[model samples]
Target: MKRTEVSFDIETIPLTIRQFINGATIYDSSCSEHAKTLFVSGSERAFLKISKRGTLEREYHMTKFLHQHNVAPNAIAYESDLDYDYLFTEAVSGEDGTAELHLENPRKLACVFGEYLKMLHSLPIEGCPYGNRTHELLNDAQINGIDLNMLNEFSYSAIDNVVIHGDYCLPNIIMDHFSFKGFIDLGYGGVGDRHYDIYWGIWTLNYNLKTDTYRDIFLDAYGRSNIDDDGLNYFTKLNKLTD
Candidate 1:
């Protein structure tokens, strides 16, 4: 699998809009044009994640941290000139779960992904320095020009302990034929509640496969027989307030 998969030690080249718009192969899961990914040199060897100028810097910091921790792809370069933060990372050696072919065994895939989140949550949160309480999240949103109502009455406190994936979705996970390889798109990940990732994980499986068939199987595989409905609902409602 490693030999067959395209990999690269990509050079330090500043990605340009022309290359992104013209020659690069775009990823299907792109949230938007600014949030899109470009396979810069083709062959899936390298890709550049381009985002608006000043939204955040956690991807650069967190990707490098997780890569060093042997949980993500190695970042090739991170450039922020004026506007737009471009993150260049080497392609991981596997098919992302978003690939249509990998959808063959959605049950196994859900279980494996659930286990990955469990492993991620087991990691200690000590020294980790991202994510925040609801107030902090709302504050940051306001700073970023997001209009959010004052939800101060809500108990928006930190429920820290487990490390969360932030966006615990299908595409963020990389797997080498049912074996977990690494994680991607981890800007929002840090110390947080495990149930949050679990909720999102289940959501993603249901969403991506267009079925809720394996939600219970996924939770069972994660060894959580009793789900945290409160935390799940909490994060869901919080996302509505802030996003």
Candidate 2:
């Protein structure tokens, strides 16, 4: 299957803010043309996420699945049109957990984040209908003219299947202090090997910190003594070749 190139944006809808705030104000932030996120609060807080081309539907379904399993934030409402999709969910307290990590001790943050990934990987996957993504990703890479031999070195080993946040990065995590509150951006959520999450966790840490030490700390906290050298090699090669 050909992968669709999707983009994201966020926008604020014209909703009365006075009912919720003593001095109600509206703040809207857009990351891109197709994605917009709105924060509204005075007494009550909620987030309005708008996306184009059915992105919200995919995210909504994934969020609902996680909520059903008692994972994180609960969905409030969702609506869509031919051109846009909207999802409203209870706002998580605190800012992006990554922001906190960057300013303070990242090693400790890595430990906490590592444990969260382990817990996430422990979720049951017997009933999930998603495809085995390790294979699927490799397949997609190959179809896109990615080198197979360079990709095969990755562990690709199937640990007990569990739900994977396909894009498990720090910014996607919401937390207060060291305590993980919830997760967002589930467009790629599905069942897969634990390494899929682990691999990306390391990748994200490396990307965020511009250092490899935190990656080691994360692996240690994750109880992994040795990195999946093969997997890392393949993914590194894959990352370079794809770019």
Candidate 3:
């Protein structure tokens, strides 16, 4: 991969010993055409996230949208460059869901994740303007010479128009201890099939843990029965091939 260097100044923030332990070096390598990086300064306790996208306009729009809906990290500061089309924002405190949770019970974690998905799916999708991820995924498979027979076996039964985080994996979910704090990576966020998000969530766990027990927990919490097992199997197989 070609690395793009961003010309910018580093801003320092105060932190304690505990904060120093948890901070990480944050970078923004989002756009395909341009490279932008955000260097977050702090320890693991608390830090900031500076991002550079393809355009500052898009980032501003997204930031405003997330803030209006109360769905994004706190925006403490921002800067834009018209010539470079770069934008930056502060990072929020919390660990991605992919990190181990301190839950006394695994089932409880699944239930909490299920409920979180439900809440996300409940968001109104009338004016969503993002890409259709299901179509994109299927298209990418074809373009990459991946077999879609597995995906074809699944049924698109429920096409509920809901706001879906295009990348619905554990890493995108942030948690404070065992409780859900918020979500990240909204660049691909938009309205789409509820199953698209649900299926991916289950698939991620199955891939990482090589178990289906958590899948059942999520389904039960969603208050639904009779998931298209064949469909899930197909999508999972397709995901493996493409991934």
Candidate 4:
């Protein structure tokens, strides 16, 4: 693999740390092409993620906060330069849900996701902070001149809000031998409508497995006797427009 040299202004660098950065393997794991994640293995494995300056603090603070809640990795190192932000965190040790072991048994894997997600959503939101509301996100997108083109506002009064993994897809979830470990790519996570997560989870399964065969099974496993078709369709359309 070709290495992308990431340069920053530093007052000093010890020889050992400089060499470690050079030897680390850059991972092409993120679905977002703009952000870069590198996996470094030594005494312990850690992941270093770098992204543009705009999201520097939001991701750093959220990941750190989630770690405090024991649902994500500890934020081991963090720094920001004029152009980019760097965050190093302990790796969530596991194979992702896409691993063939899980793929061979899709129903079981979906059950794992279902149960784990239920636990995540139940985390108390009282004093827990730092999440972007869906309304605010849509407003920000419109302000930036994105073509929303007649998306109707959904009633918050009707929808139940829960802690959501803003991008709750298979790849972002880590699994160890079909057992749930933890979550990754939590930059968009926070209190939001349950449908936001359900939409993405189903979409991700459809996307990765190259079929929609398992969508209903996933919902059943997640313990919903009836599907929320209205909520799912609304959020899916909204996401496509804003995304």
lDDT of candidate 4 vs native? 0.69
Q: Candidate 4 lDDT, tens digit per residue, 1-243?
A: 223544432233233334445545445444458787766665547776778766646666667777777887777767776787777778888877788878888878777777777777777765446544666656677897866554455432224367777788887788889776777778887677777888888888888888888887788777684346676777777778766
- Candidate 2 on 62-110: residue-level lDDT in tens? 7877876776677777777667777777677765656844438778777
Ordered by lDDT, highest first, the candidates read 4, 1, 2, 3
lDDT of 1 by residue, 115-210 (tens): 887778777666666745334555676787665444344454437667677888888888888788899888887776776678788788988899
All candidates: CA RMSD (Å): 5.9, 6.6, 7.5, 4.2
Question: Pick by TM-score: which candidate is best?
Answer: 4
Per-candidate TM equals 0.75, 0.78, 0.65, 0.81
Candidate 3: clashing pairs of residues: 19-43, 20-43, 21-44, 22-43, 22-44, 23-43, 23-44, 49-91, 154-231
- Candidate 1 stretches greater than 4 Å from native: 1-31, 42-44, 131-135, 138-158, 225-227, 240-243
Please give the range of 10 consecutive residues that has the lowest summed lDDT in model 1.
Answer: 1-10
The residue-by-residue lDDT of candidate 3 on 1-243, one tens digit each, is 112334333433222222432434544334333444453544432223333435444444454455556666644444443334333444555666655552345576677778888877776665565546567667777899986664555564434366777667766677777577766656566665666677878876665556778888887786585345655565557667877
Clashes in candidate 4: how many? 0
CA displacement after TM-score superposition, residue 55 of candidate 1 (Å):
3.4
Any runs in candidate 2 off by more than 4 Å, and if so which? Answer: 1-25, 42-44, 127-129, 153-160, 225-228
